[model samples]
Target: MTVALMWEARAVAGKGEELLTWATHQPLDPPPLRRETFRAPEDRVLVITWWEGTYDTEGLPELPEPGEDLVRRAVHRWRFETVADGV
Candidate 1:
């Protein structure tokens, strides 16, 4: 099945441009880039990306995560295979 990987993070202080730069410049291969973003009511931004490929976070490089607080960066990737017409 098709999958959609969503990630959201608040603008740190005045890091809006930095945030977008970091996300857009991520170095990941085998998964073609498909990214979109939006501004929330509270000014927080929501960035959703559709990665077309198998789901394997374990194999990907590790990202920075806060000790107590939630990840500044997160991923919600889902993988689904296609079905045959005769199946």
Candidate 2:
């Protein structure tokens, strides 16, 4: 099975670039199958990582949160399992 983890955060006013830089530089000890980063209006940043296990798997790698001052609110995270594929 394939598991994908999503992490999203909203940066403080006028610090979108700094927040994006911070998110891209974070390292996963064992690394995931794939990872991607994105940014949006209102200074929001999103990171998604794909792994080869279930959401409850032990010791799965995940990105840690950045400093409090970097963001305006708590980060949001979610886990999902792939259920279908397109031709």
Candidate 3:
């Protein structure tokens, strides 16, 4: 099964583009199979990465957090088992 890691952050006022730029450039160890990023109203950035492994396995690197100066609040993260893909 494929596991997906979701990360989200809200940038400080007027810094949404900077936040998105930072997220787009982040490097993942053992690179993920796929990654996508999104921006929402209110300076929120969301990143989702798909890996070819399960959550129980060892050696899964944790997602890195953005610099403290770039965000208004703490980053949020979640993991999920992909149930379906491509419609």
Question: Backbone collision count in every prediction?
Answer: 2, 0, 0
Say what the RMSD of model 3 is.
1.5
Give the least accurate 10-residue stretch of model 3, judged by summed lDDT.
55-64
Model 2 over residues 1-87: C-alpha lDDT tens digits?
889999999999999999999999999978899999999999999999999987686777888888999999899999998887676
- The positional error of residue 8 in candidate 3, measured at the CA in angstroms, is 0.3
Q: Please name the candidate that would achieve the greatest lDDT relative to the true structure.
A: 2
Candidate 2 lDDT score relative to the true structure: 0.92
lDDT: the better of candidates 1 and 2: 2
Ranking by lDDT: 2, 3, 1
TM-score for each of the candidates: 0.48, 0.94, 0.88
Candidate 2's C-alpha runs over 4 A off are none
Model 3 over residues 46-81: C-alpha lDDT tens digits?
999888888655565556788888899889988888
What C-alpha lDDT values do all the predictions have?
0.47, 0.92, 0.87
Give the lDDT of residue 27 in candidate 2.
93
- Sort the candidates on TM-score, descending order: 2, 3, 1
Q: Please list the residue runs of candidate 3 whose C-alpha ends up more than 4 Å from where it truly belongs after superposition.
A: 85-87
